[model samples]
Target: MVTRIAKCTCGQLQIVVEGEPLGVGVCHCFACQSRTGSVFAALAAFSPDYRVSGRATDYIRTGDQGARFRFRFCPVCGSNLYHTEEGEEHRSVAVAVGAFADPDFPPPQDSVYDCRRHRWVKLPDGVTVYEKDPE
Candidate 1:
Protein backbone atom coordinates (compact mmCIF):
# COMPACT_ATOMS: atom_id res chain seq x y z
CA MET A 1 0.00 0.00 0.00
CA VAL A 2 1.33 3.41 -0.99
CA THR A 3 0.95 6.05 1.69
CA ARG A 4 1.00 9.80 1.05
CA ILE A 5 0.78 12.71 3.42
CA ALA A 6 -1.06 15.98 2.91
CA LYS A 7 -0.79 18.84 5.33
CA CYS A 8 -1.81 22.41 5.81
CA THR A 9 0.60 25.23 5.01
CA CYS A 10 1.36 25.70 8.69
CA GLY A 11 1.72 21.97 9.36
CA GLN A 12 -1.03 22.27 11.89
CA LEU A 13 -3.29 19.64 10.37
CA GLN A 14 -2.18 16.61 8.40
CA ILE A 15 -3.81 13.71 6.62
CA VAL A 16 -2.19 10.44 5.65
CA VAL A 17 -3.87 8.61 2.84
CA GLU A 18 -3.24 4.98 2.07
CA GLY A 19 -3.19 3.51 -1.40
CA GLU A 20 -3.92 5.56 -4.48
CA PRO A 21 -6.56 8.22 -4.83
CA LEU A 22 -9.95 7.16 -6.10
CA GLY A 23 -10.16 10.18 -8.41
CA VAL A 24 -8.08 13.26 -9.18
CA GLY A 25 -9.86 16.17 -10.73
CA VAL A 26 -10.11 19.92 -11.12
CA CYS A 27 -13.19 22.04 -10.55
CA HIS A 28 -13.79 25.37 -12.22
CA CYS A 29 -16.97 26.08 -10.35
CA PHE A 30 -17.26 29.56 -8.86
CA ALA A 31 -17.46 28.15 -5.37
CA CYS A 32 -14.19 26.27 -5.82
CA GLN A 33 -12.53 29.32 -7.30
CA SER A 34 -13.56 31.45 -4.35
CA ARG A 35 -12.70 28.81 -1.81
CA THR A 36 -9.21 28.22 -3.19
CA GLY A 37 -8.63 31.87 -4.15
CA SER A 38 -7.38 30.46 -7.45
CA VAL A 39 -8.90 30.12 -10.87
CA PHE A 40 -9.77 26.58 -10.00
CA ALA A 41 -9.40 23.98 -7.34
CA ALA A 42 -7.49 20.75 -7.73
CA LEU A 43 -8.50 17.85 -5.53
CA ALA A 44 -7.98 14.17 -5.06
CA ALA A 45 -10.67 12.00 -3.56
CA PHE A 46 -9.69 9.02 -1.44
CA SER A 47 -11.55 6.40 0.46
CA PRO A 48 -12.06 6.37 4.24
CA ASP A 49 -8.80 4.44 4.57
CA TYR A 50 -7.04 7.55 5.80
CA ARG A 51 -6.05 9.16 9.06
CA VAL A 52 -5.83 12.70 10.30
CA SER A 53 -3.79 14.36 13.03
CA GLY A 54 -4.00 17.74 14.73
CA ARG A 55 -7.10 19.83 15.18
CA ALA A 56 -8.96 21.48 12.32
CA THR A 57 -11.78 23.98 11.99
CA ASP A 58 -14.82 23.07 10.00
CA TYR A 59 -16.91 25.18 7.66
CA ILE A 60 -20.04 23.76 6.16
CA ARG A 61 -21.02 24.88 2.69
CA THR A 62 -23.99 24.15 0.55
CA GLY A 63 -23.12 23.51 -3.06
CA ASP A 64 -25.01 24.58 -6.12
CA GLN A 65 -26.58 21.18 -6.19
CA GLY A 66 -27.59 21.61 -2.52
CA ALA A 67 -25.10 19.05 -1.35
CA ARG A 68 -23.56 20.05 1.94
CA PHE A 69 -19.80 19.73 2.40
CA ARG A 70 -17.93 20.04 5.62
CA PHE A 71 -14.61 21.70 4.91
CA ARG A 72 -11.83 20.97 7.31
CA PHE A 73 -9.06 23.53 7.44
CA CYS A 74 -6.17 24.34 9.65
CA PRO A 75 -7.37 26.74 12.28
CA VAL A 76 -4.02 28.52 12.47
CA CYS A 77 -3.05 28.95 8.86
CA GLY A 78 -6.55 28.55 7.47
CA SER A 79 -5.36 26.24 4.72
CA ASN A 80 -8.12 23.95 3.59
CA LEU A 81 -7.09 20.37 4.08
CA TYR A 82 -10.07 18.35 2.98
CA HIS A 83 -13.84 18.22 2.69
CA THR A 84 -16.49 15.54 2.79
CA GLU A 85 -20.07 15.49 1.71
CA GLU A 86 -22.67 15.33 4.45
CA GLY A 87 -26.04 13.57 4.65
CA GLU A 88 -25.15 11.38 1.69
CA GLU A 89 -23.36 8.60 3.47
CA HIS A 90 -20.32 9.82 1.55
CA ARG A 91 -17.30 7.71 2.16
CA SER A 92 -14.70 9.71 0.30
CA VAL A 93 -12.70 12.66 1.54
CA ALA A 94 -11.54 15.13 -1.05
CA VAL A 95 -8.20 16.64 -0.22
CA ALA A 96 -6.77 19.73 -1.79
CA VAL A 97 -4.14 18.52 -4.24
CA GLY A 98 -1.88 21.51 -3.63
CA ALA A 99 -1.46 20.36 -0.05
CA PHE A 100 0.37 17.29 -1.33
CA ALA A 101 3.10 19.57 -2.72
CA ASP A 102 4.33 16.84 -5.06
CA PRO A 103 5.06 17.96 -8.58
CA ASP A 104 5.26 14.35 -9.60
CA PHE A 105 1.76 13.64 -8.34
CA PRO A 106 -0.72 12.25 -10.78
CA PRO A 107 -2.38 14.78 -13.06
CA PRO A 108 -6.08 15.50 -12.99
CA GLN A 109 -8.19 13.27 -15.22
CA ASP A 110 -11.47 15.14 -14.84
CA SER A 111 -12.40 18.79 -15.20
CA VAL A 112 -15.81 19.83 -13.97
CA TYR A 113 -17.76 23.10 -14.42
CA ASP A 114 -15.73 23.89 -17.51
CA CYS A 115 -18.24 26.51 -18.49
CA ARG A 116 -16.73 28.76 -15.88
CA ARG A 117 -13.14 27.89 -16.77
CA HIS A 118 -11.00 30.85 -17.67
CA ARG A 119 -10.40 31.08 -21.37
CA TRP A 120 -6.67 31.56 -20.87
CA VAL A 121 -6.44 28.39 -18.89
CA LYS A 122 -5.77 25.18 -20.78
CA LEU A 123 -6.32 21.73 -19.40
CA PRO A 124 -4.18 18.67 -20.02
CA ASP A 125 -5.10 16.77 -23.14
CA GLY A 126 -7.56 13.88 -22.85
CA VAL A 127 -9.20 15.10 -19.65
CA THR A 128 -12.93 14.55 -19.49
CA VAL A 129 -14.53 17.98 -19.43
CA TYR A 130 -17.98 18.68 -18.11
CA GLU A 131 -19.68 21.99 -18.77
CA LYS A 132 -21.34 21.70 -15.41
CA ASP A 133 -21.61 19.35 -12.52
CA PRO A 134 -22.88 15.95 -13.60
CA GLU A 135 -25.96 15.25 -11.61
Candidate 2:
Protein backbone atom coordinates (compact mmCIF):
# COMPACT_ATOMS: atom_id res chain seq x y z
CA MET A 1 0.00 0.00 0.00
CA VAL A 2 1.20 3.49 -0.76
CA THR A 3 0.87 6.24 1.78
CA ARG A 4 1.10 9.98 1.16
CA ILE A 5 1.13 12.85 3.59
CA ALA A 6 -0.02 16.46 2.99
CA LYS A 7 0.63 19.21 5.43
CA CYS A 8 -0.35 22.84 5.79
CA THR A 9 2.15 25.64 5.33
CA CYS A 10 2.69 26.04 9.04
CA GLY A 11 2.65 22.28 9.58
CA GLN A 12 -0.23 22.74 11.98
CA LEU A 13 -2.50 20.35 10.12
CA GLN A 14 -1.84 17.20 8.15
CA ILE A 15 -3.59 14.45 6.25
CA VAL A 16 -2.44 10.88 5.71
CA VAL A 17 -3.91 8.65 3.07
CA GLU A 18 -3.04 5.10 2.12
CA GLY A 19 -3.52 3.71 -1.35
CA GLU A 20 -4.12 5.57 -4.58
CA PRO A 21 -6.69 8.34 -4.84
CA LEU A 22 -10.13 7.80 -6.30
CA GLY A 23 -9.50 10.68 -8.70
CA VAL A 24 -7.30 13.66 -9.32
CA GLY A 25 -8.74 16.67 -11.10
CA VAL A 26 -8.63 20.38 -11.75
CA CYS A 27 -11.68 22.59 -11.26
CA HIS A 28 -12.08 25.83 -13.15
CA CYS A 29 -15.36 27.01 -11.72
CA PHE A 30 -15.37 30.62 -10.64
CA ALA A 31 -15.89 29.58 -7.08
CA CYS A 32 -12.95 27.26 -7.21
CA GLN A 33 -10.75 29.85 -8.82
CA SER A 34 -11.71 32.37 -6.21
CA ARG A 35 -11.20 29.94 -3.37
CA THR A 36 -7.76 28.94 -4.55
CA GLY A 37 -6.78 32.41 -5.77
CA SER A 38 -5.58 30.65 -8.89
CA VAL A 39 -6.89 30.00 -12.36
CA PHE A 40 -7.97 26.55 -11.19
CA ALA A 41 -8.01 24.33 -8.16
CA ALA A 42 -6.33 20.95 -8.18
CA LEU A 43 -7.54 18.29 -5.83
CA ALA A 44 -7.32 14.59 -5.17
CA ALA A 45 -10.24 12.60 -3.88
CA PHE A 46 -9.77 9.71 -1.50
CA SER A 47 -11.92 7.08 0.05
CA PRO A 48 -13.13 7.44 3.60
CA ASP A 49 -10.01 5.60 4.66
CA TYR A 50 -7.70 8.43 5.69
CA ARG A 51 -6.55 10.25 8.79
CA VAL A 52 -6.23 13.88 9.78
CA SER A 53 -4.09 15.42 12.48
CA GLY A 54 -3.64 18.83 14.10
CA ARG A 55 -6.15 21.68 14.23
CA ALA A 56 -8.10 23.19 11.37
CA THR A 57 -10.80 25.77 10.83
CA ASP A 58 -13.71 25.03 8.55
CA TYR A 59 -15.86 27.08 6.21
CA ILE A 60 -18.95 25.77 4.47
CA ARG A 61 -20.24 27.12 1.19
CA THR A 62 -23.12 26.16 -1.03
CA GLY A 63 -22.29 25.60 -4.66
CA ASP A 64 -24.40 27.03 -7.44
CA GLN A 65 -26.28 23.75 -7.57
CA GLY A 66 -27.03 23.96 -3.88
CA ALA A 67 -24.66 21.24 -2.76
CA ARG A 68 -22.60 22.35 0.20
CA PHE A 69 -18.92 21.65 0.73
CA ARG A 70 -17.02 22.16 3.92
CA PHE A 71 -13.44 23.34 3.46
CA ARG A 72 -10.95 22.94 6.26
CA PHE A 73 -7.84 25.07 6.48
CA CYS A 74 -4.96 25.37 8.83
CA PRO A 75 -5.68 28.04 11.38
CA VAL A 76 -2.05 28.84 11.88
CA CYS A 77 -1.16 29.65 8.29
CA GLY A 78 -4.58 29.80 6.63
CA SER A 79 -3.63 27.19 4.08
CA ASN A 80 -6.57 25.37 2.57
CA LEU A 81 -6.08 21.68 3.25
CA TYR A 82 -9.14 19.63 2.47
CA HIS A 83 -12.86 19.55 1.95
CA THR A 84 -15.86 17.24 1.85
CA GLU A 85 -19.39 17.53 0.61
CA GLU A 86 -22.31 17.69 2.95
CA GLY A 87 -23.35 14.26 4.26
CA GLU A 88 -20.20 12.77 2.74
CA GLU A 89 -17.66 14.13 5.16
CA HIS A 90 -16.90 10.70 6.49
CA ARG A 91 -17.28 8.84 3.21
CA SER A 92 -14.94 10.92 1.08
CA VAL A 93 -12.53 13.83 1.09
CA ALA A 94 -10.77 16.09 -1.41
CA VAL A 95 -7.36 17.40 -0.55
CA ALA A 96 -5.57 20.25 -2.23
CA VAL A 97 -2.82 18.82 -4.44
CA GLY A 98 -0.64 21.87 -3.82
CA ALA A 99 -0.71 21.09 -0.12
CA PHE A 100 1.33 18.01 -0.77
CA ALA A 101 4.05 20.02 -2.54
CA ASP A 102 5.14 16.76 -4.11
CA PRO A 103 6.68 17.02 -7.52
CA ASP A 104 5.94 13.37 -8.05
CA PHE A 105 2.25 13.50 -7.24
CA PRO A 106 0.03 12.12 -9.95
CA PRO A 107 -0.94 14.58 -12.65
CA PRO A 108 -4.55 15.62 -13.01
CA GLN A 109 -6.60 13.10 -14.90
CA ASP A 110 -9.79 15.14 -15.13
CA SER A 111 -10.83 18.70 -15.75
CA VAL A 112 -14.13 20.17 -14.54
CA TYR A 113 -15.88 23.43 -15.30
CA ASP A 114 -13.85 23.81 -18.43
CA CYS A 115 -16.43 26.30 -19.64
CA ARG A 116 -14.86 28.73 -17.27
CA ARG A 117 -11.32 27.63 -17.90
CA HIS A 118 -9.02 30.44 -18.89
CA ARG A 119 -8.05 30.47 -22.52
CA TRP A 120 -4.39 30.83 -21.58
CA VAL A 121 -4.46 27.70 -19.48
CA LYS A 122 -3.81 24.54 -21.41
CA LEU A 123 -4.73 21.17 -19.98
CA PRO A 124 -2.46 18.23 -20.46
CA ASP A 125 -3.23 15.82 -23.28
CA GLY A 126 -5.32 12.73 -22.52
CA VAL A 127 -7.19 14.47 -19.71
CA THR A 128 -10.90 13.77 -19.44
CA VAL A 129 -12.46 17.17 -20.02
CA TYR A 130 -15.84 18.31 -18.77
CA GLU A 131 -17.50 21.62 -19.55
CA LYS A 132 -19.02 21.29 -16.15
CA ASP A 133 -19.02 18.76 -13.39
CA PRO A 134 -20.38 15.35 -14.28
CA GLU A 135 -23.90 14.87 -13.15
Candidate 3:
Protein backbone atom coordinates (compact mmCIF):
# COMPACT_ATOMS: atom_id res chain seq x y z
CA MET A 1 0.00 0.00 0.00
CA VAL A 2 1.23 3.46 -0.82
CA THR A 3 1.17 6.12 1.88
CA ARG A 4 0.75 9.86 1.53
CA ILE A 5 0.88 12.74 3.99
CA ALA A 6 -1.46 15.69 3.97
CA LYS A 7 -0.76 18.73 6.08
CA CYS A 8 -2.41 22.00 6.95
CA THR A 9 -1.11 25.25 5.58
CA CYS A 10 0.72 26.08 8.78
CA GLY A 11 1.82 22.50 9.23
CA GLN A 12 -0.03 22.30 12.53
CA LEU A 13 -2.19 19.37 11.50
CA GLN A 14 -1.11 16.33 9.53
CA ILE A 15 -2.80 13.22 8.25
CA VAL A 16 -1.29 10.01 6.93
CA VAL A 17 -3.37 8.03 4.51
CA GLU A 18 -2.67 4.41 3.71
CA GLY A 19 -3.23 2.99 0.24
CA GLU A 20 -4.74 4.78 -2.71
CA PRO A 21 -7.98 6.69 -2.23
CA LEU A 22 -11.27 4.90 -2.74
CA GLY A 23 -12.39 7.64 -5.12
CA VAL A 24 -11.76 11.18 -6.17
CA GLY A 25 -14.28 13.77 -7.21
CA VAL A 26 -15.14 17.42 -7.54
CA CYS A 27 -18.09 19.18 -5.92
CA HIS A 28 -19.66 22.42 -7.10
CA CYS A 29 -22.57 22.73 -4.70
CA PHE A 30 -23.18 26.07 -3.04
CA ALA A 31 -22.15 24.65 0.28
CA CYS A 32 -18.88 23.43 -1.15
CA GLN A 33 -18.24 26.78 -2.79
CA SER A 34 -18.84 28.56 0.51
CA ARG A 35 -16.71 26.15 2.47
CA THR A 36 -13.83 26.23 0.02
CA GLY A 37 -14.20 29.87 -0.90
CA SER A 38 -13.66 28.74 -4.44
CA VAL A 39 -15.62 27.70 -7.50
CA PHE A 40 -15.37 24.05 -6.51
CA ALA A 41 -13.71 21.61 -4.18
CA ALA A 42 -11.52 18.72 -5.23
CA LEU A 43 -11.69 15.79 -2.86
CA ALA A 44 -10.08 12.41 -2.37
CA ALA A 45 -11.94 9.86 -0.30
CA PHE A 46 -10.16 7.58 2.10
CA SER A 47 -11.35 4.84 4.39
CA PRO A 48 -11.16 5.00 8.18
CA ASP A 49 -7.67 3.55 8.14
CA TYR A 50 -6.13 7.01 7.86
CA ARG A 51 -4.44 8.55 10.89
CA VAL A 52 -4.47 12.16 11.93
CA SER A 53 -2.02 13.93 14.20
CA GLY A 54 -1.65 17.41 15.66
CA ARG A 55 -4.25 20.03 16.55
CA ALA A 56 -7.34 20.77 14.48
CA THR A 57 -10.81 22.22 14.87
CA ASP A 58 -14.12 21.11 13.46
CA TYR A 59 -17.10 23.02 12.13
CA ILE A 60 -20.41 21.21 11.82
CA ARG A 61 -23.04 22.31 9.35
CA THR A 62 -26.20 20.91 7.83
CA GLY A 63 -26.44 20.51 4.07
CA ASP A 64 -29.44 21.16 1.85
CA GLN A 65 -30.50 17.55 2.23
CA GLY A 66 -30.30 17.91 6.01
CA ALA A 67 -27.18 15.83 6.09
CA ARG A 68 -24.61 16.95 8.64
CA PHE A 69 -21.02 17.59 7.56
CA ARG A 70 -18.13 17.96 9.91
CA PHE A 71 -15.29 20.01 8.47
CA ARG A 72 -11.90 19.81 10.09
CA PHE A 73 -9.45 22.67 9.76
CA CYS A 74 -6.12 23.66 11.09
CA PRO A 75 -6.31 25.64 14.29
CA VAL A 76 -3.30 27.74 13.34
CA CYS A 77 -3.71 28.61 9.67
CA GLY A 78 -7.42 27.82 9.36
CA SER A 79 -6.98 25.71 6.25
CA ASN A 80 -9.84 23.27 5.75
CA LEU A 81 -8.23 19.88 5.60
CA TYR A 82 -10.89 17.23 5.56
CA HIS A 83 -14.55 16.48 6.17
CA THR A 84 -16.87 13.62 6.96
CA GLU A 85 -20.55 13.33 6.27
CA GLU A 86 -23.17 12.03 8.66
CA GLY A 87 -24.18 8.38 8.17
CA GLU A 88 -21.71 7.85 5.31
CA GLU A 89 -20.71 4.24 5.02
CA HIS A 90 -17.14 2.89 5.27
CA ARG A 91 -16.30 5.73 7.64
CA SER A 92 -15.06 7.60 4.61
CA VAL A 93 -13.37 10.93 5.00
CA ALA A 94 -12.87 13.36 2.13
CA VAL A 95 -9.63 15.25 2.21
CA ALA A 96 -8.66 18.36 0.31
CA VAL A 97 -6.62 17.17 -2.64
CA GLY A 98 -4.67 20.39 -2.63
CA ALA A 99 -3.25 19.44 0.72
CA PHE A 100 -1.18 16.78 -0.94
CA ALA A 101 0.53 19.34 -3.22
CA ASP A 102 1.25 16.62 -5.73
CA PRO A 103 0.79 17.51 -9.33
CA ASP A 104 0.94 13.86 -10.32
CA PHE A 105 -2.01 12.80 -8.21
CA PRO A 106 -4.80 11.19 -10.15
CA PRO A 107 -7.48 13.43 -11.60
CA PRO A 108 -11.03 13.44 -10.32
CA GLN A 109 -13.25 10.73 -11.71
CA ASP A 110 -16.51 12.54 -11.06
CA SER A 111 -17.87 16.06 -11.08
CA VAL A 112 -21.05 16.55 -9.06
CA TYR A 113 -23.56 19.33 -8.67
CA ASP A 114 -22.90 20.45 -12.21
CA CYS A 115 -26.13 22.37 -12.00
CA ARG A 116 -24.35 24.83 -9.75
CA ARG A 117 -21.02 24.68 -11.50
CA HIS A 118 -19.83 27.99 -12.78
CA ARG A 119 -20.17 28.48 -16.51
CA TRP A 120 -16.55 29.60 -16.70
CA VAL A 121 -15.20 26.65 -14.82
CA LYS A 122 -13.95 23.97 -17.15
CA LEU A 123 -14.02 20.36 -16.08
CA PRO A 124 -11.50 17.83 -17.33
CA ASP A 125 -12.50 15.73 -20.25
CA GLY A 126 -14.07 12.28 -19.75
CA VAL A 127 -15.19 12.70 -16.13
CA THR A 128 -18.64 11.49 -15.13
CA VAL A 129 -20.80 14.55 -14.67
CA TYR A 130 -23.77 14.57 -12.33
CA GLU A 131 -26.40 17.22 -11.96
CA LYS A 132 -26.47 16.19 -8.34
CA ASP A 133 -25.11 13.49 -6.16
CA PRO A 134 -25.20 10.04 -7.74
CA GLU A 135 -27.52 7.64 -6.03
Candidate 4:
Protein backbone atom coordinates (compact mmCIF):
# COMPACT_ATOMS: atom_id res chain seq x y z
CA MET A 1 0.00 0.00 0.00
CA VAL A 2 1.24 3.48 -0.79
CA THR A 3 1.83 5.92 2.06
CA ARG A 4 0.01 9.22 2.29
CA ILE A 5 1.17 12.44 3.90
CA ALA A 6 -0.66 15.19 5.82
CA LYS A 7 0.75 18.57 6.67
CA CYS A 8 -0.01 21.45 8.98
CA THR A 9 -1.49 24.66 7.69
CA CYS A 10 1.86 26.45 7.83
CA GLY A 11 3.65 23.38 6.49
CA GLN A 12 5.70 23.33 9.65
CA LEU A 13 4.52 19.89 10.55
CA GLN A 14 4.15 16.96 8.18
CA ILE A 15 3.17 13.38 8.89
CA VAL A 16 3.76 10.50 6.54
CA VAL A 17 1.35 7.71 7.23
CA GLU A 18 1.95 4.19 5.98
CA GLY A 19 -1.00 3.02 3.95
CA GLU A 20 -4.56 3.80 5.03
CA PRO A 21 -5.88 4.31 8.53
CA LEU A 22 -7.11 1.40 10.60
CA GLY A 23 -10.33 3.36 11.04
CA VAL A 24 -11.80 6.83 11.11
CA GLY A 25 -14.55 8.19 13.34
CA VAL A 26 -16.12 11.16 14.99
CA CYS A 27 -15.98 11.31 18.76
CA HIS A 28 -18.66 13.34 20.42
CA CYS A 29 -17.36 12.30 23.83
CA PHE A 30 -16.93 15.02 26.42
CA ALA A 31 -13.16 14.62 26.50
CA CYS A 32 -12.98 15.35 22.81
CA GLN A 33 -15.39 18.24 23.15
CA SER A 34 -13.36 19.80 25.93
CA ARG A 35 -10.05 19.20 24.22
CA THR A 36 -11.17 20.56 20.87
CA GLY A 37 -13.69 23.04 22.22
CA SER A 38 -16.11 21.58 19.70
CA VAL A 39 -19.05 19.20 19.55
CA PHE A 40 -16.96 16.39 18.14
CA ALA A 41 -13.50 15.29 17.00
CA ALA A 42 -12.72 13.45 13.81
CA LEU A 43 -9.86 10.96 14.06
CA ALA A 44 -7.97 8.71 11.65
CA ALA A 45 -6.13 5.70 12.96
CA PHE A 46 -2.64 4.96 11.61
CA SER A 47 0.46 2.95 12.38
CA PRO A 48 3.05 4.07 14.95
CA ASP A 49 5.65 4.19 12.21
CA TYR A 50 3.88 7.31 11.00
CA ARG A 51 6.74 9.73 10.38
CA VAL A 52 6.32 13.24 11.71
CA SER A 53 8.49 16.24 10.85
CA GLY A 54 8.78 19.64 12.51
CA ARG A 55 8.87 20.42 16.20
CA ALA A 56 5.95 19.23 18.32
CA THR A 57 4.75 19.48 21.88
CA ASP A 58 3.21 16.70 23.86
CA TYR A 59 0.29 16.71 26.24
CA ILE A 60 -0.15 13.39 27.97
CA ARG A 61 -3.57 12.31 29.10
CA THR A 62 -4.52 9.28 31.12
CA GLY A 63 -6.81 7.15 29.03
CA ASP A 64 -9.68 4.93 30.20
CA GLN A 65 -7.17 2.13 30.73
CA GLY A 66 -4.99 4.35 32.90
CA ALA A 67 -2.30 4.16 30.23
CA ARG A 68 -0.98 7.53 29.18
CA PHE A 69 -1.71 8.53 25.62
CA ARG A 70 0.54 11.26 24.33
CA PHE A 71 -1.05 13.74 21.98
CA ARG A 72 1.46 15.45 19.70
CA PHE A 73 0.96 18.57 17.65
CA CYS A 74 2.85 21.32 15.93
CA PRO A 75 4.13 23.87 18.42
CA VAL A 76 3.80 26.62 15.87
CA CYS A 77 0.21 26.35 14.59
CA GLY A 78 -1.11 23.90 17.15
CA SER A 79 -2.33 21.58 14.44
CA ASN A 80 -3.23 18.31 16.14
CA LEU A 81 -1.25 15.45 14.65
CA TYR A 82 -1.47 12.07 16.31
CA HIS A 83 -2.04 10.36 19.67
CA THR A 84 0.02 7.45 20.83
CA GLU A 85 0.61 5.06 23.71
CA GLU A 86 3.63 6.09 25.76
CA GLY A 87 6.94 4.30 25.38
CA GLU A 88 8.46 3.84 21.95
CA GLU A 89 6.99 0.38 21.46
CA HIS A 90 3.42 0.85 20.40
CA ARG A 91 2.62 0.37 16.71
CA SER A 92 -0.33 2.65 16.15
CA VAL A 93 -1.36 6.27 16.02
CA ALA A 94 -4.72 8.01 15.77
CA VAL A 95 -4.21 10.99 13.48
CA ALA A 96 -6.49 13.95 13.46
CA VAL A 97 -8.52 13.26 10.33
CA GLY A 98 -9.12 16.96 9.74
CA ALA A 99 -5.39 17.39 9.30
CA PHE A 100 -5.54 15.74 5.94
CA ALA A 101 -4.91 18.10 3.04
CA ASP A 102 -6.89 15.87 0.73
CA PRO A 103 -10.49 16.90 0.38
CA ASP A 104 -11.47 13.34 -0.43
CA PHE A 105 -10.41 11.58 2.75
CA PRO A 106 -12.46 8.53 3.60
CA PRO A 107 -15.18 8.61 6.23
CA PRO A 108 -15.11 6.99 9.64
CA GLN A 109 -16.21 3.48 10.33
CA ASP A 110 -17.22 3.94 13.96
CA SER A 111 -18.10 6.38 16.71
CA VAL A 112 -16.54 5.82 20.09
CA TYR A 113 -17.11 6.99 23.66
CA ASP A 114 -20.73 7.58 22.73
CA CYS A 115 -21.96 7.20 26.30
CA ARG A 116 -20.58 10.65 26.82
CA ARG A 117 -21.65 11.82 23.37
CA HIS A 118 -23.62 15.02 23.42
CA ARG A 119 -27.34 14.40 23.56
CA TRP A 120 -28.05 17.26 21.17
CA VAL A 121 -25.76 15.82 18.54
CA LYS A 122 -26.50 12.87 16.31
CA LEU A 123 -24.12 10.72 14.27
CA PRO A 124 -25.06 9.59 10.78
CA ASP A 125 -26.52 6.16 10.03
CA GLY A 126 -24.73 2.85 9.32
CA VAL A 127 -21.53 3.29 11.35
CA THR A 128 -20.67 1.34 14.48
CA VAL A 129 -21.23 3.22 17.73
CA TYR A 130 -19.62 2.39 21.05
CA GLU A 131 -20.61 3.70 24.44
CA LYS A 132 -17.00 3.62 25.53
CA ASP A 133 -13.66 3.21 23.81
CA PRO A 134 -13.76 0.15 21.62
CA GLU A 135 -11.34 -2.59 22.48
How much lDDT does candidate 4 score?
Answer: 0.80
lDDT of 1 by residue, 46-94 (tens): 9887899999999999988899999998999989999999965358889
- Return the TM-score for each candidate structure: 0.96, 0.95, 0.93, 0.86
Candidate 3: 10-residue stretch with minimal lDDT? 82-91
Winning candidate number (TM-score): 1
Q: Encode model 3's per-residue lDDT on 56-75: one tens digit a residue.
A: 89999987667888899998
Report the C-alpha displacement of residue 85, candidate 2, in angstroms.
Answer: 0.7
Residues 1-135, candidate 4, lDDT per residue (tens digit)?
Answer: 968887766889888988878878988767778777688889888877778888888898887767787888788987777788787437678877777867789877899888887788777678899888876
Clashes by residue pair, model 1: none
Best by lDDT: 1
Pairwise TM-score winner, candidates 1 and 3: 1
Can you rank all candidates by lDDT, best first? 1, 2, 3, 4
Task: Give the alpha-carbon lDDT of every model.
Answer: 0.93, 0.92, 0.91, 0.80
How many collisions per candidate? Answer: 0, 0, 0, 1
| Model 4 C-alpha RMSD to native | 1.9
Question: RMSD in angstroms, candidate 3?
Answer: 1.3
1-135: candidate 2 lDDT, tens digit per residue: 998899999898999988898999999999989988999999999987889999999999998778899999898998999999998777789999998889989999999999999999999899999999886
With a 3 Å backbone cut-off (N, CA, C), the pairs that clash in candidate 2 are none
User: Which of the two candidates, 2 or 3, achieves a greater lDDT against the reference?
Assistant: 2
